[model samples]
Target: MDRQFSDRVEAGRVLAAHLEHLKDRSDLLVLGLPRGGVPVAKEVASALGAPLDVLVVRKLGAPGQPELAIGAIASGGVQVLSRDLIEQLHVSASRLATEIEKQLKELDRRERQYRGDRPFPDLEGKTLLVIDDGLATGSTMEAAVRALRQHEPRAIIVAVPVAPSHVSSSLLSAADEFIAVERPQSFMAVGQFYRRFDQTSDEEVREILAAHTHSGE
Candidate 1:
């Protein structure tokens, strides 16, 4: 697993180039999945001269295996679970419910913290580009697309810098367009593809959003 990107910023720039066709489109909106996706998305928004915002999504990790996502929850009460995984692991209903509740609370907190009094942007009949640093199981992005559908976006595009080949394929039908910079066959983890895959903090997400808002103003 060789590092394909120097950092998220560089990955965003590269992704922006791939998405050059969308530059300056009035109907285009770029929403990044925080907090890592926000930095990558900031670069995309700047490159395309498009409005930038955050789409808060939290992965529902399996109990005692925090890195393995059994599901994901997004804003607007959208919850998606990998039933097959749950069945395979034999996760108890009670345990799953508890995880969902915990994640929902975090989701609510993130929404309030990231957007504050700002209203969610209108997406009706618009082309939405949902971005992340990378895709692993694609569960989080799946939840995001499902939630955004309620807003009636004309099209949804999931863009990432790197993802496993199989994971990217699985997401193709979930979004109007699925774009991945590198779909390595020997994929290990999203972080393995980036030289600087540090944890993205809440303050970083807030600062990026604030800068975007100020620039728009």
Candidate 2:
């Protein structure tokens, strides 16, 4: 049985319901994985009275199979690669280096475009809630957790609307807490759980962030 929501807003609202108990946590911050995670994060932040920010993670796609992530990189040059995958796929050292450089450039470009001059929130001793629309491959989410761990947050929680049971289980070990609205046995793709899985544009992301900034001030 495949249950789909009306849109990201609905998913956010639903996911937020699961996190309502954390509303009173003063040191909580929400970081979304753009460009799909911002809108969802906004709703979560609004509901929880937590500040919202973006966590840009660029996937280092495998050679030829671009969708398959050989490795992933997050902001501040946090990189994680699967050595087994690299060895099995026979990815050359030079080729891996090239992809990493490309991903780093993209990570920086996205940070500038989406969050120009906005300093990353200080996660030290804060309960950081990392939100995304959904999880697939789980590599990107793992990379995000790894990057955030560098900041020494008091706790880390990975929350999403939907993810495969297996992927969600694997991700639990990476974060202090992992919560998802639904973990189906036959999870196919993230889009399958959303009726409106439209590609979020950069302009939309900018608008949302700007609106939040203005409202907060």
Candidate 3:
């Protein structure tokens, strides 16, 4: 209920402590879920001395309730839907198609805006640490994990500052390992845990990635 972190940067530092074992592992790679996740992940990558990259994912929220995710789409055309939610909502096929198309366009635009000419990092046989500011539904993270699976990462670890205690089972099953700094029972939203939860912009995401890339060079 109380503010657990001053901001995403602080959250990342706290998470890095718990993930200290992964520090300096050549096989490890840190992939952040942009745009909010990038700042947190930047700290994690710095702490771990690993390469950092972004995994673009868009949440497909339910009709009329944009905050409630019905599914998610990730890079490389990987899509994951909650069939139960879809059936329960009775979301029309046309509506779902339109949403998916819209999100896919946004994903593509983000990829171009963030990475520019740089190619996506290779994940084959690597240990991936998927970082996010926090998790609420876990749908977007699940989509990211499924997409990464196609590249055959040796392992996938989903790391976040906070998440609902109830989403643990699903996230754990989705990733090889899942770590949450705080799993509160009374979790309402991810932003509530932070004292300053400002929206992360596309420009910020680009700058962070550029800085990380330069530091690596």
Candidate achieving the largest lDDT: 3
Q: Give model 1's TM-score versus the native structure.
A: 0.86
lDDT of 2 by residue, 108-134 (tens): 888888888977667789999999999
TM-score for all models, in order of appearance: 0.86, 0.90, 0.88
Stronger candidate by lDDT (2 vs 3):
3
- Reference-based lDDT, residue 118, model 1: 90
lDDT of 3 by residue, 19-105 (tens): 999999999999999989999999999999999999998889899998888888876566888899999999999999999999999
TM-score: model 3 vs. ground truth: 0.88
C-alpha displacement of 92 in model 1, angstroms? 7.4
Which is superior by lDDT, 1 or 3?
A: 3
Ranking by TM-score: 2, 3, 1
Cα error, candidate 3, residue 7 (Å): 1.2
lDDT of 1: 0.88
Q: Which ten residues in a row have the lowest lDDT in candidate 1?
A: 72-81
lDDT of each: 0.88, 0.87, 0.91
Clashing pairs in 2: none
